[model samples]
Target: IMVLLVLIFHLLFSCSHSLQYFYTAVTRGINFPELTAVGMIDGEKFLYYDGNTRQAIPKVDWIKNNVKPDYWTSQTQIIRGSEDRYKASLVTAMQRFNQSGGYYHPFQWMYGCELDGETGATDGYSQFGYDGADFLYLELRSTSYVAPVQQALITKQEWDVAEAERRKHYLTKECIYWLKKYVYYGKSILDRKVPPQVSLLQRDPSSPVVCHATGFYPDNVKISWQKDGQELHEDVDVGETLPNHDGTFQKRAELKVTPDVWKKNQFTCVVEHKSGDPIHMILTEEKIRTNSAGIIVGLVVAALVLIAVVVGVVMVVKR
Candidate 1:
Protein backbone atom coordinates (compact mmCIF):
# COMPACT_ATOMS: atom_id res chain seq x y z
CA ILE A 1 0.00 0.00 0.00
CA MET A 2 2.81 2.38 0.86
CA VAL A 3 4.66 1.63 -2.36
CA LEU A 4 1.53 2.11 -4.39
CA LEU A 5 0.83 5.39 -2.63
CA VAL A 6 4.36 6.58 -3.32
CA LEU A 7 3.99 5.71 -7.02
CA ILE A 8 0.69 7.57 -7.11
CA PHE A 9 2.24 10.61 -5.49
CA HIS A 10 5.10 10.63 -7.99
CA LEU A 11 2.69 10.48 -10.88
CA LEU A 12 0.56 13.23 -9.36
CA PHE A 13 3.56 15.50 -9.04
CA SER A 14 4.72 14.74 -12.57
CA CYS A 15 1.30 15.37 -14.03
CA SER A 16 1.03 18.63 -12.15
CA HIS A 17 4.34 19.85 -13.59
CA SER A 18 3.24 18.68 -17.00
CA LEU A 19 0.06 20.72 -16.72
CA GLN A 20 2.05 23.77 -15.67
CA TYR A 21 4.33 23.35 -18.66
CA PHE A 22 1.35 22.82 -20.94
CA TYR A 23 -0.37 25.93 -19.62
CA THR A 24 2.75 28.06 -20.09
CA ALA A 25 3.25 26.77 -23.66
CA VAL A 26 -0.29 27.53 -24.80
CA THR A 27 -0.51 30.88 -23.05
CA ARG A 28 2.93 31.91 -24.35
CA GLY A 29 2.18 31.25 -28.04
CA ILE A 30 2.84 27.54 -28.54
CA ASN A 31 -0.65 27.17 -29.89
CA PHE A 32 -2.17 23.69 -29.81
CA PRO A 33 -5.68 23.70 -31.22
CA GLU A 34 -6.19 20.20 -29.87
CA LEU A 35 -4.84 20.95 -26.37
CA THR A 36 -6.44 19.33 -23.33
CA ALA A 37 -5.43 18.97 -19.70
CA VAL A 38 -4.71 15.33 -19.00
CA GLY A 39 -2.50 15.11 -15.86
CA MET A 40 -1.12 17.12 -12.88
CA ILE A 41 1.29 17.06 -9.92
CA ASP A 42 1.51 20.58 -8.51
CA GLY A 43 -1.93 21.91 -8.49
CA GLU A 44 0.90 24.46 -9.13
CA LYS A 45 1.25 23.39 -12.75
CA PHE A 46 0.87 26.43 -14.98
CA LEU A 47 -2.04 26.26 -17.42
CA TYR A 48 -3.76 28.54 -19.89
CA TYR A 49 -7.52 28.31 -19.59
CA ASP A 50 -9.04 26.71 -22.67
CA GLY A 51 -12.59 28.03 -22.97
CA ASN A 52 -13.44 25.47 -25.62
CA THR A 53 -12.35 22.35 -23.74
CA ARG A 54 -12.13 23.89 -20.29
CA GLN A 55 -8.79 22.09 -19.82
CA ALA A 56 -5.04 22.28 -20.70
CA ILE A 57 -2.00 20.18 -21.75
CA PRO A 58 1.02 19.39 -19.65
CA LYS A 59 3.48 21.95 -20.96
CA VAL A 60 6.67 20.33 -22.16
CA ASP A 61 9.94 21.55 -20.63
CA TRP A 62 10.92 23.62 -23.68
CA ILE A 63 7.69 25.58 -23.94
CA LYS A 64 9.12 29.03 -23.25
CA ASN A 65 7.27 31.91 -21.61
CA ASN A 66 8.15 35.57 -22.27
CA VAL A 67 7.47 37.41 -19.04
CA LYS A 68 9.19 40.68 -18.09
CA PRO A 69 10.92 41.07 -14.75
CA ASP A 70 12.32 44.22 -13.26
CA TYR A 71 16.48 42.78 -13.08
CA TRP A 72 19.74 42.62 -15.17
CA THR A 73 22.57 40.25 -16.38
CA SER A 74 25.67 40.18 -18.67
CA GLN A 75 24.21 37.81 -21.24
CA THR A 76 21.32 40.25 -21.52
CA GLN A 77 22.68 42.42 -24.33
CA ILE A 78 20.10 44.32 -26.36
CA ILE A 79 20.33 43.35 -29.99
CA ARG A 80 17.79 43.97 -32.73
CA GLY A 81 16.08 41.71 -35.21
CA SER A 82 13.15 42.31 -37.58
CA GLU A 83 10.17 43.44 -35.52
CA ASP A 84 7.49 42.70 -38.10
CA ARG A 85 7.26 39.26 -36.48
CA TYR A 86 6.86 40.54 -32.91
CA LYS A 87 3.92 39.81 -30.68
CA ALA A 88 1.05 42.30 -30.74
CA SER A 89 1.96 43.66 -27.30
CA LEU A 90 5.47 44.49 -28.51
CA VAL A 91 4.15 46.02 -31.72
CA THR A 92 1.68 48.13 -29.77
CA ALA A 93 4.40 49.26 -27.40
CA MET A 94 6.54 50.48 -30.28
CA GLN A 95 3.64 52.25 -31.96
CA ARG A 96 2.87 54.06 -28.74
CA PHE A 97 6.49 55.17 -28.48
CA ASN A 98 6.49 56.41 -32.06
CA GLN A 99 3.22 58.23 -31.43
CA SER A 100 4.72 59.82 -28.31
CA GLY A 101 7.55 61.38 -30.42
CA GLY A 102 10.24 58.76 -29.67
CA TYR A 103 12.43 57.88 -32.65
CA TYR A 104 11.45 54.44 -33.85
CA HIS A 105 14.34 53.50 -36.05
CA PRO A 106 15.72 50.02 -36.73
CA PHE A 107 18.96 48.99 -34.94
CA GLN A 108 19.02 51.93 -32.57
CA TRP A 109 22.19 51.57 -30.49
CA MET A 110 21.19 52.68 -27.02
CA TYR A 111 23.72 53.63 -24.32
CA GLY A 112 24.41 51.14 -21.54
CA CYS A 113 26.36 51.41 -18.26
CA GLU A 114 26.57 49.82 -14.83
CA LEU A 115 23.44 50.19 -12.75
CA ASP A 116 25.63 52.19 -10.35
CA GLY A 117 27.67 54.83 -12.15
CA GLU A 118 29.74 57.77 -10.84
CA THR A 119 29.40 59.90 -14.02
CA GLY A 120 26.52 62.30 -13.69
CA ALA A 121 25.85 61.53 -17.35
CA THR A 122 26.15 57.93 -18.55
CA ASP A 123 28.78 57.34 -21.29
CA GLY A 124 27.68 55.32 -24.36
CA TYR A 125 26.43 55.50 -27.93
CA SER A 126 23.14 57.39 -27.96
CA GLN A 127 22.07 56.06 -31.36
CA PHE A 128 23.23 54.72 -34.72
CA GLY A 129 21.47 54.73 -38.08
CA TYR A 130 21.07 51.93 -40.58
CA ASP A 131 21.94 52.82 -44.19
CA GLY A 132 21.64 49.89 -46.57
CA ALA A 133 20.17 46.93 -44.72
CA ASP A 134 16.42 47.07 -44.37
CA PHE A 135 15.89 47.65 -40.67
CA LEU A 136 13.63 44.96 -39.35
CA TYR A 137 11.87 46.27 -36.25
CA LEU A 138 14.28 46.28 -33.31
CA GLU A 139 14.05 43.53 -30.72
CA LEU A 140 16.05 43.17 -27.48
CA ARG A 141 16.33 39.44 -26.79
CA SER A 142 18.43 37.05 -24.66
CA THR A 143 19.69 33.55 -25.44
CA SER A 144 21.02 33.11 -21.90
CA TYR A 145 17.72 31.40 -21.16
CA VAL A 146 16.02 30.11 -24.28
CA ALA A 147 18.30 30.62 -27.28
CA PRO A 148 15.47 30.80 -29.77
CA VAL A 149 13.05 32.81 -27.66
CA GLN A 150 13.02 36.65 -27.53
CA GLN A 151 11.16 39.34 -25.62
CA ALA A 152 10.43 42.67 -27.20
CA LEU A 153 8.92 46.01 -26.20
CA ILE A 154 8.57 49.22 -28.16
CA THR A 155 8.93 51.17 -24.96
CA LYS A 156 12.08 49.80 -23.29
CA GLN A 157 13.30 53.33 -24.08
CA GLU A 158 12.20 54.25 -20.60
CA TRP A 159 15.07 52.13 -19.26
CA ASP A 160 17.57 53.43 -21.83
CA VAL A 161 19.26 56.09 -19.68
CA ALA A 162 22.57 55.23 -18.02
CA GLU A 163 22.01 55.50 -14.26
CA ALA A 164 25.02 53.59 -12.87
CA GLU A 165 28.83 53.03 -13.19
CA ARG A 166 28.79 50.46 -15.95
CA ARG A 167 25.58 52.03 -17.09
CA LYS A 168 26.53 52.02 -20.73
CA HIS A 169 26.66 48.26 -20.83
CA TYR A 170 23.80 48.07 -18.33
CA LEU A 171 21.67 50.48 -20.33
CA THR A 172 22.38 48.49 -23.45
CA LYS A 173 21.63 45.45 -21.34
CA GLU A 174 18.45 46.45 -19.46
CA CYS A 175 15.87 45.36 -22.01
CA ILE A 176 17.37 41.91 -22.33
CA TYR A 177 17.85 41.71 -18.57
CA TRP A 178 14.30 42.70 -17.86
CA LEU A 179 13.06 40.25 -20.46
CA LYS A 180 14.98 37.36 -18.89
CA LYS A 181 13.91 38.29 -15.39
CA TYR A 182 10.34 38.71 -16.41
CA VAL A 183 10.00 35.88 -18.84
CA TYR A 184 12.49 33.04 -18.23
CA TYR A 185 13.22 30.69 -15.39
CA GLY A 186 16.80 29.39 -15.41
CA LYS A 187 16.60 25.72 -16.28
CA SER A 188 18.88 23.07 -17.80
CA ILE A 189 19.80 24.15 -21.31
CA LEU A 190 19.45 21.83 -24.29
CA ASP A 191 22.74 20.09 -24.99
CA ARG A 192 23.86 21.88 -28.12
CA LYS A 193 25.65 19.87 -30.89
CA VAL A 194 28.24 21.27 -33.26
CA PRO A 195 28.43 19.21 -36.47
CA PRO A 196 25.80 16.58 -37.24
CA GLN A 197 26.25 13.64 -39.62
CA VAL A 198 24.35 12.80 -42.83
CA SER A 199 23.60 9.55 -44.56
CA LEU A 200 21.45 8.61 -47.60
CA LEU A 201 19.78 5.24 -48.09
CA GLN A 202 16.80 3.35 -49.53
CA ARG A 203 17.23 3.83 -53.27
CA ASP A 204 14.79 2.23 -55.72
CA PRO A 205 12.73 2.71 -58.89
CA SER A 206 8.99 2.78 -59.74
CA SER A 207 7.91 4.75 -56.63
CA PRO A 208 9.37 7.71 -54.76
CA VAL A 209 12.12 6.45 -52.48
CA VAL A 210 12.44 7.80 -48.93
CA CYS A 211 15.85 9.31 -48.19
CA HIS A 212 16.86 8.73 -44.60
CA ALA A 213 19.29 11.33 -43.28
CA THR A 214 20.30 11.28 -39.64
CA GLY A 215 22.67 12.64 -36.96
CA PHE A 216 22.09 16.35 -36.43
CA TYR A 217 23.13 18.73 -33.71
CA PRO A 218 21.98 22.06 -32.20
CA ASP A 219 18.35 20.95 -32.05
CA ASN A 220 17.55 23.64 -34.62
CA VAL A 221 19.42 21.86 -37.40
CA LYS A 222 17.77 21.89 -40.83
CA ILE A 223 17.97 19.11 -43.43
CA SER A 224 17.48 19.65 -47.15
CA TRP A 225 17.91 17.32 -50.10
CA GLN A 226 18.87 17.95 -53.73
CA LYS A 227 18.64 16.14 -57.03
CA ASP A 228 21.62 16.20 -59.43
CA GLY A 229 22.78 19.05 -57.14
CA GLN A 230 19.59 21.16 -57.24
CA GLU A 231 17.74 21.83 -54.02
CA LEU A 232 14.53 19.92 -53.53
CA HIS A 233 11.43 22.06 -53.93
CA GLU A 234 8.89 19.52 -52.79
CA ASP A 235 7.86 19.48 -49.15
CA VAL A 236 10.01 17.08 -47.18
CA ASP A 237 8.68 15.17 -44.18
CA VAL A 238 10.39 15.18 -40.75
CA GLY A 239 10.30 12.40 -38.18
CA GLU A 240 10.80 12.40 -34.43
CA THR A 241 13.73 10.65 -32.77
CA LEU A 242 14.03 8.82 -29.53
CA PRO A 243 14.77 11.60 -27.02
CA ASN A 244 18.24 11.40 -25.45
CA HIS A 245 16.76 12.96 -22.26
CA ASP A 246 20.04 14.89 -22.00
CA GLY A 247 18.68 17.81 -24.10
CA THR A 248 19.99 17.05 -27.61
CA PHE A 249 17.28 15.91 -30.01
CA GLN A 250 17.69 13.19 -32.63
CA LYS A 251 15.63 13.66 -35.77
CA ARG A 252 15.32 12.52 -39.38
CA ALA A 253 14.33 14.16 -42.66
CA GLU A 254 12.85 12.15 -45.49
CA LEU A 255 12.60 13.27 -49.11
CA LYS A 256 10.75 11.31 -51.77
CA VAL A 257 11.82 11.39 -55.40
CA THR A 258 10.99 9.54 -58.59
CA PRO A 259 13.25 6.66 -59.54
CA ASP A 260 14.06 8.30 -62.85
CA VAL A 261 15.81 11.09 -60.98
CA TRP A 262 17.74 8.58 -58.90
CA LYS A 263 18.56 6.38 -61.88
CA LYS A 264 21.43 8.27 -63.47
CA ASN A 265 21.80 11.31 -61.20
CA GLN A 266 23.49 11.86 -57.88
CA PHE A 267 21.05 12.44 -55.00
CA THR A 268 22.35 14.43 -52.09
CA CYS A 269 20.99 14.96 -48.60
CA VAL A 270 22.74 17.84 -46.88
CA VAL A 271 22.79 18.32 -43.15
CA GLU A 272 23.36 21.97 -42.35
CA HIS A 273 25.52 21.83 -39.24
CA LYS A 274 25.38 24.82 -36.94
CA SER A 275 29.17 25.20 -36.69
CA GLY A 276 31.00 22.89 -39.12
CA ASP A 277 31.13 21.73 -42.72
CA PRO A 278 27.72 20.52 -43.85
CA ILE A 279 27.50 16.72 -43.88
CA HIS A 280 26.42 15.37 -47.25
CA MET A 281 24.65 12.16 -48.13
CA ILE A 282 25.16 10.93 -51.67
CA LEU A 283 23.27 8.16 -53.48
CA THR A 284 23.96 6.69 -56.92
CA GLU A 285 22.27 3.81 -58.66
CA GLU A 286 23.67 1.10 -60.93
CA LYS A 287 21.54 -0.67 -63.53
CA ILE A 288 20.42 -4.19 -62.58
CA ARG A 289 18.41 -6.51 -64.87
CA THR A 290 17.07 -10.10 -64.74
CA ASN A 291 16.68 -12.35 -67.82
CA SER A 292 12.98 -13.23 -68.12
CA ALA A 293 13.34 -15.10 -71.45
CA GLY A 294 15.59 -17.89 -70.02
CA ILE A 295 13.31 -18.32 -67.03
CA ILE A 296 10.22 -18.66 -69.32
CA VAL A 297 11.90 -21.41 -71.43
CA GLY A 298 12.93 -23.37 -68.27
CA LEU A 299 9.39 -23.16 -66.91
CA VAL A 300 7.99 -24.51 -70.18
CA VAL A 301 10.30 -27.55 -70.14
CA ALA A 302 9.44 -28.30 -66.47
CA ALA A 303 5.71 -28.22 -67.30
CA LEU A 304 6.23 -30.66 -70.19
CA VAL A 305 8.11 -33.13 -67.92
CA LEU A 306 5.37 -32.93 -65.30
CA ILE A 307 2.67 -33.72 -67.95
CA ALA A 308 4.64 -36.75 -69.21
CA VAL A 309 5.00 -38.06 -65.65
CA VAL A 310 1.24 -37.75 -65.10
CA VAL A 311 0.49 -39.65 -68.35
CA GLY A 312 2.90 -42.45 -67.41
CA VAL A 313 1.26 -42.89 -63.99
CA VAL A 314 -2.19 -43.17 -65.65
CA MET A 315 -0.95 -45.80 -68.13
CA VAL A 316 0.61 -47.86 -65.32
CA VAL A 317 -2.64 -47.74 -63.34
CA LYS A 318 -4.73 -48.73 -66.39
CA ARG A 319 -2.44 -51.73 -67.13
Candidate 2:
Protein backbone atom coordinates (compact mmCIF):
# COMPACT_ATOMS: atom_id res chain seq x y z
CA ILE A 1 0.00 0.00 0.00
CA MET A 2 2.83 2.41 0.82
CA VAL A 3 4.62 1.56 -2.42
CA LEU A 4 1.47 2.22 -4.40
CA LEU A 5 1.05 5.60 -2.71
CA VAL A 6 4.63 6.54 -3.43
CA LEU A 7 4.23 5.62 -7.09
CA ILE A 8 1.11 7.73 -7.29
CA PHE A 9 2.92 10.69 -5.74
CA HIS A 10 5.75 10.36 -8.23
CA LEU A 11 3.39 10.24 -11.18
CA LEU A 12 1.29 13.17 -10.02
CA PHE A 13 4.24 15.49 -9.35
CA SER A 14 6.37 14.49 -12.34
CA CYS A 15 5.43 17.76 -13.97
CA SER A 16 7.20 21.03 -13.20
CA HIS A 17 4.21 22.86 -11.75
CA SER A 18 1.05 21.43 -10.23
CA LEU A 19 -1.68 22.46 -7.80
CA GLN A 20 -3.79 19.85 -6.03
CA TYR A 21 -6.46 19.77 -3.32
CA PHE A 22 -7.59 16.68 -1.42
CA TYR A 23 -10.64 16.28 0.83
CA THR A 24 -11.35 13.22 2.97
CA ALA A 25 -14.45 12.40 5.00
CA VAL A 26 -15.20 9.41 7.13
CA THR A 27 -18.26 7.88 8.77
CA ARG A 28 -18.82 7.74 12.54
CA GLY A 29 -17.14 4.44 13.25
CA ILE A 30 -13.65 5.83 12.78
CA ASN A 31 -11.82 7.65 15.57
CA PHE A 32 -10.94 10.53 13.25
CA PRO A 33 -12.29 13.94 12.46
CA GLU A 34 -15.28 14.01 10.11
CA LEU A 35 -13.53 15.90 7.36
CA THR A 36 -10.04 17.07 6.41
CA ALA A 37 -8.73 19.07 3.47
CA VAL A 38 -5.21 19.66 2.15
CA GLY A 39 -3.79 21.87 -0.55
CA MET A 40 -0.43 21.15 -2.18
CA ILE A 41 1.71 22.85 -4.76
CA ASP A 42 4.32 20.81 -6.62
CA GLY A 43 3.86 17.90 -4.23
CA GLU A 44 4.60 20.08 -1.16
CA LYS A 45 1.78 20.65 1.31
CA PHE A 46 1.06 24.38 1.80
CA LEU A 47 -2.45 24.52 3.27
CA TYR A 48 -4.32 22.27 5.67
CA TYR A 49 -7.78 22.31 7.30
CA ASP A 50 -9.54 19.76 9.43
CA GLY A 51 -12.93 19.37 11.05
CA ASN A 52 -11.32 19.40 14.49
CA THR A 53 -9.40 22.61 13.93
CA ARG A 54 -12.09 24.38 11.86
CA GLN A 55 -9.40 26.78 10.70
CA ALA A 56 -7.35 26.89 7.51
CA ILE A 57 -3.66 26.79 8.45
CA PRO A 58 -0.61 27.41 6.33
CA LYS A 59 1.88 24.59 6.20
CA VAL A 60 4.88 26.49 4.81
CA ASP A 61 6.69 29.62 5.78
CA TRP A 62 6.14 31.25 2.40
CA ILE A 63 2.41 30.70 2.58
CA LYS A 64 2.19 32.06 6.11
CA ASN A 65 4.32 35.08 5.25
CA ASN A 66 2.91 35.93 1.82
CA VAL A 67 -0.78 35.10 2.11
CA LYS A 68 -3.08 37.40 4.03
CA PRO A 69 -5.14 36.47 7.07
CA ASP A 70 -8.33 37.28 5.17
CA TYR A 71 -7.56 34.54 2.69
CA TRP A 72 -7.42 31.98 5.47
CA THR A 73 -10.65 33.29 6.98
CA SER A 74 -12.48 32.97 3.66
CA GLN A 75 -11.02 29.52 3.07
CA THR A 76 -12.10 28.44 6.53
CA GLN A 77 -15.71 29.45 5.82
CA ILE A 78 -15.73 27.73 2.43
CA ILE A 79 -14.22 24.55 3.82
CA ARG A 80 -16.66 24.55 6.73
CA GLY A 81 -19.51 24.57 4.23
CA SER A 82 -17.84 21.77 2.32
CA GLU A 83 -17.45 19.78 5.51
CA ASP A 84 -21.22 19.98 6.15
CA ARG A 85 -22.07 18.94 2.60
CA TYR A 86 -19.56 16.07 2.64
CA LYS A 87 -20.95 14.80 5.95
CA ALA A 88 -24.44 14.64 4.48
CA SER A 89 -23.05 13.00 1.36
CA LEU A 90 -21.39 10.31 3.48
CA VAL A 91 -24.72 9.50 5.09
CA THR A 92 -26.34 9.36 1.67
CA ALA A 93 -23.57 7.06 0.45
CA MET A 94 -24.18 4.71 3.37
CA GLN A 95 -27.83 4.49 2.36
CA ARG A 96 -26.90 4.02 -1.28
CA PHE A 97 -24.65 1.09 -0.34
CA ASN A 98 -27.26 -0.27 2.05
CA GLN A 99 -24.77 -0.15 4.87
CA SER A 100 -26.05 -0.29 8.45
CA GLY A 101 -24.59 0.84 11.76
CA GLY A 102 -21.04 0.31 13.08
CA TYR A 103 -19.33 0.11 9.72
CA TYR A 104 -16.45 2.45 8.92
CA HIS A 105 -16.54 4.06 5.50
CA PRO A 106 -14.27 6.65 3.98
CA PHE A 107 -14.78 9.01 1.05
CA GLN A 108 -12.25 11.11 -0.78
CA TRP A 109 -12.37 13.92 -3.35
CA MET A 110 -9.33 15.16 -5.27
CA TYR A 111 -8.92 17.82 -7.95
CA GLY A 112 -5.79 19.22 -9.48
CA CYS A 113 -4.20 21.03 -12.40
CA GLU A 114 -0.71 20.58 -13.86
CA LEU A 115 1.28 23.01 -15.92
CA ASP A 116 4.27 22.19 -18.14
CA GLY A 117 7.06 24.63 -17.60
CA GLU A 118 8.65 24.31 -21.01
CA THR A 119 5.72 23.78 -23.36
CA GLY A 120 3.13 25.89 -21.53
CA ALA A 121 0.68 22.94 -21.69
CA THR A 122 -1.86 22.25 -18.97
CA ASP A 123 -3.87 19.25 -17.68
CA GLY A 124 -6.66 18.93 -15.14
CA TYR A 125 -8.39 16.12 -13.27
CA SER A 126 -11.14 15.61 -10.68
CA GLN A 127 -11.89 12.29 -9.06
CA PHE A 128 -13.55 10.67 -6.06
CA GLY A 129 -12.96 7.48 -4.13
CA TYR A 130 -15.09 5.45 -1.73
CA ASP A 131 -13.69 2.92 0.70
CA GLY A 132 -10.28 3.06 -0.97
CA ALA A 133 -11.66 2.41 -4.44
CA ASP A 134 -12.45 4.64 -7.33
CA PHE A 135 -16.09 5.69 -7.29
CA LEU A 136 -16.36 8.47 -9.87
CA TYR A 137 -14.22 10.72 -12.04
CA LEU A 138 -14.75 13.62 -14.38
CA GLU A 139 -14.23 13.28 -18.12
CA LEU A 140 -13.24 16.74 -19.20
CA ARG A 141 -13.36 16.02 -22.91
CA SER A 142 -17.03 14.94 -22.76
CA THR A 143 -17.97 17.20 -19.85
CA SER A 144 -19.52 14.23 -18.05
CA TYR A 145 -18.98 12.15 -14.93
CA VAL A 146 -17.98 8.49 -15.03
CA ALA A 147 -19.14 6.09 -12.35
CA PRO A 148 -16.66 3.35 -11.73
CA VAL A 149 -18.75 1.52 -9.18
CA GLN A 150 -22.42 0.54 -9.08
CA GLN A 151 -23.02 2.53 -5.89
CA ALA A 152 -21.88 5.76 -7.59
CA LEU A 153 -24.06 5.36 -10.68
CA ILE A 154 -27.03 7.05 -9.07
CA THR A 155 -24.97 10.06 -8.10
CA LYS A 156 -23.52 10.26 -11.60
CA GLN A 157 -26.98 10.17 -13.10
CA GLU A 158 -28.10 13.05 -10.92
CA TRP A 159 -25.14 15.26 -11.90
CA ASP A 160 -26.00 17.37 -14.93
CA VAL A 161 -23.71 18.57 -17.71
CA ALA A 162 -23.84 22.12 -16.35
CA GLU A 163 -22.24 21.03 -13.09
CA ALA A 164 -19.55 19.18 -15.01
CA GLU A 165 -18.89 22.29 -17.04
CA ARG A 166 -18.51 24.33 -13.89
CA ARG A 167 -16.06 21.80 -12.45
CA LYS A 168 -14.08 21.79 -15.67
CA HIS A 169 -13.88 25.57 -15.74
CA TYR A 170 -12.69 25.71 -12.17
CA LEU A 171 -10.05 23.00 -12.72
CA THR A 172 -8.65 24.50 -15.90
CA LYS A 173 -8.97 28.24 -15.36
CA GLU A 174 -9.32 29.10 -11.68
CA CYS A 175 -7.02 26.37 -10.40
CA ILE A 176 -4.27 27.39 -12.80
CA TYR A 177 -4.67 31.04 -11.83
CA TRP A 178 -4.23 30.23 -8.17
CA LEU A 179 -1.34 27.91 -8.94
CA LYS A 180 0.53 30.68 -10.74
CA LYS A 181 -0.13 33.11 -7.93
CA TYR A 182 1.18 30.65 -5.34
CA VAL A 183 4.22 29.87 -7.44
CA TYR A 184 5.13 33.55 -7.60
CA TYR A 185 4.63 33.87 -3.87
CA GLY A 186 6.92 30.89 -3.13
CA LYS A 187 9.52 31.39 -5.82
CA SER A 188 12.39 31.70 -3.39
CA ILE A 189 11.93 28.35 -1.65
CA LEU A 190 10.58 26.46 -4.64
CA ASP A 191 13.28 27.63 -7.02
CA ARG A 192 16.22 27.05 -4.74
CA LYS A 193 18.33 23.88 -5.18
CA VAL A 194 19.87 21.70 -2.47
CA PRO A 195 22.03 18.66 -3.04
CA PRO A 196 21.59 15.36 -1.28
CA GLN A 197 23.93 13.63 1.18
CA VAL A 198 24.57 10.13 -0.13
CA SER A 199 25.66 7.04 1.79
CA LEU A 200 25.88 3.28 1.36
CA LEU A 201 24.39 1.23 4.17
CA GLN A 202 23.95 -2.48 4.93
CA ARG A 203 22.26 -4.15 7.85
CA ASP A 204 24.48 -7.24 7.75
CA PRO A 205 26.98 -8.91 5.45
CA SER A 206 24.21 -10.89 3.72
CA SER A 207 21.77 -8.00 3.19
CA PRO A 208 21.57 -5.87 0.10
CA VAL A 209 23.61 -2.66 0.07
CA VAL A 210 21.29 0.33 0.11
CA CYS A 211 22.40 3.63 -1.42
CA HIS A 212 20.57 6.21 0.65
CA ALA A 213 20.28 9.88 -0.26
CA THR A 214 18.59 12.43 1.94
CA GLY A 215 18.12 16.19 2.49
CA PHE A 216 17.58 17.12 -1.14
CA TYR A 217 15.07 19.66 -2.44
CA PRO A 218 12.71 19.10 -5.40
CA ASP A 219 11.78 15.44 -5.10
CA ASN A 220 12.89 14.48 -8.60
CA VAL A 221 16.05 12.40 -8.16
CA LYS A 222 17.68 9.50 -9.95
CA ILE A 223 19.56 6.74 -8.10
CA SER A 224 21.08 3.76 -9.82
CA TRP A 225 23.66 1.05 -9.24
CA GLN A 226 26.59 0.39 -11.52
CA LYS A 227 28.92 -2.59 -11.73
CA ASP A 228 32.43 -1.87 -13.07
CA GLY A 229 31.23 1.59 -14.26
CA GLN A 230 28.29 0.12 -16.19
CA GLU A 231 24.68 0.50 -15.07
CA LEU A 232 23.13 -2.69 -13.72
CA HIS A 233 19.37 -2.98 -14.11
CA GLU A 234 18.97 -6.48 -12.68
CA ASP A 235 19.35 -7.27 -8.98
CA VAL A 236 18.42 -3.67 -8.19
CA ASP A 237 15.42 -2.22 -6.36
CA VAL A 238 14.78 1.51 -6.60
CA GLY A 239 12.67 2.95 -3.84
CA GLU A 240 10.49 6.05 -4.02
CA THR A 241 11.44 9.55 -2.97
CA LEU A 242 10.01 10.41 0.44
CA PRO A 243 9.78 13.77 2.22
CA ASN A 244 12.01 14.41 5.23
CA HIS A 245 10.95 16.15 8.42
CA ASP A 246 12.74 19.33 7.32
CA GLY A 247 10.84 19.41 3.99
CA THR A 248 13.80 17.96 2.04
CA PHE A 249 13.48 14.70 0.08
CA GLN A 250 15.05 11.26 0.56
CA LYS A 251 15.46 8.24 -1.73
CA ARG A 252 17.26 4.92 -1.83
CA ALA A 253 18.28 2.21 -4.30
CA GLU A 254 19.43 -1.21 -3.24
CA LEU A 255 21.95 -3.44 -5.01
CA LYS A 256 21.86 -7.17 -4.49
CA VAL A 257 25.22 -8.85 -4.95
CA THR A 258 27.41 -11.38 -3.22
CA PRO A 259 30.56 -10.36 -1.36
CA ASP A 260 32.73 -12.04 -3.97
CA VAL A 261 31.10 -10.26 -6.92
CA TRP A 262 31.39 -6.80 -5.36
CA LYS A 263 34.92 -7.51 -4.18
CA LYS A 264 35.99 -8.47 -7.70
CA ASN A 265 34.30 -5.61 -9.54
CA GLN A 266 33.77 -1.92 -8.76
CA PHE A 267 30.25 -1.28 -7.48
CA THR A 268 29.13 2.31 -7.46
CA CYS A 269 25.91 4.14 -6.58
CA VAL A 270 25.18 7.17 -8.70
CA VAL A 271 22.80 9.96 -7.74
CA GLU A 272 21.61 12.68 -10.06
CA HIS A 273 19.95 15.85 -8.81
CA LYS A 274 19.13 19.23 -10.28
CA SER A 275 21.24 20.99 -7.67
CA GLY A 276 24.61 20.16 -9.15
CA ASP A 277 26.66 17.46 -10.85
CA PRO A 278 25.83 13.83 -10.38
CA ILE A 279 27.25 12.16 -7.24
CA HIS A 280 29.05 8.83 -7.39
CA MET A 281 29.89 6.62 -4.42
CA ILE A 282 32.09 3.55 -4.86
CA LEU A 283 30.93 0.74 -2.61
CA THR A 284 33.57 -0.61 -0.20
CA GLU A 285 33.58 -2.83 2.88
CA GLU A 286 35.06 -0.09 5.05
CA LYS A 287 32.40 2.42 3.99
CA ILE A 288 29.44 0.30 5.16
CA ARG A 289 28.79 -0.28 8.89
CA THR A 290 27.40 -3.77 9.22
CA ASN A 291 25.33 -5.10 12.13
CA SER A 292 28.03 -7.51 13.29
CA ALA A 293 30.63 -4.74 13.52
CA GLY A 294 28.12 -2.52 15.32
CA ILE A 295 27.43 -5.29 17.85
CA ILE A 296 31.13 -5.80 18.52
CA VAL A 297 31.62 -2.06 18.99
CA GLY A 298 28.63 -1.95 21.35
CA LEU A 299 30.06 -4.79 23.46
CA VAL A 300 33.45 -3.05 23.67
CA VAL A 301 31.80 0.16 24.83
CA ALA A 302 29.78 -1.76 27.40
CA ALA A 303 32.89 -3.49 28.72
CA LEU A 304 34.64 -0.13 29.09
CA VAL A 305 31.67 1.25 31.03
CA LEU A 306 31.66 -1.79 33.36
CA ILE A 307 35.39 -1.34 34.08
CA ALA A 308 34.83 2.37 34.83
CA VAL A 309 31.98 1.54 37.24
CA VAL A 310 34.17 -1.04 39.06
CA VAL A 311 37.03 1.49 39.31
CA GLY A 312 34.65 4.13 40.69
CA VAL A 313 33.39 1.71 43.38
CA VAL A 314 36.94 0.78 44.40
CA MET A 315 37.97 4.46 44.60
CA VAL A 316 34.90 5.33 46.77
CA VAL A 317 35.72 2.45 49.17
CA LYS A 318 39.35 3.52 49.41
CA ARG A 319 38.24 7.15 50.13
Best by TM-score, which number? 2
Q: Model 1: runs farther than 4 Å from truth? A: 1-191, 201-207, 212-215, 235-245, 285-319
Each candidate's TM vs. the true structure?
0.32, 0.79
Cα deviation in Å at residue 265, candidate 1? 1.0
Give lDDT tens digits, candidate 1, residues 184-285: 241222223345544444433443444433344334556777877898777466553322223233455655656665666776767775557777767554
Number of the top-ranking candidate, with lDDT as the measure: 2
The runs of at least 3 residues in candidate 2 whose Cα sits more than 4 Å from the true structure, single-residue gaps closed, are 1-15, 95-98, 101-103, 291-319
Each candidate's lDDT (Cα)? 0.34, 0.77
lDDT of 2 by residue, 140-203 (tens): 8888998978998888887747779899999889998888778878877776688999878777
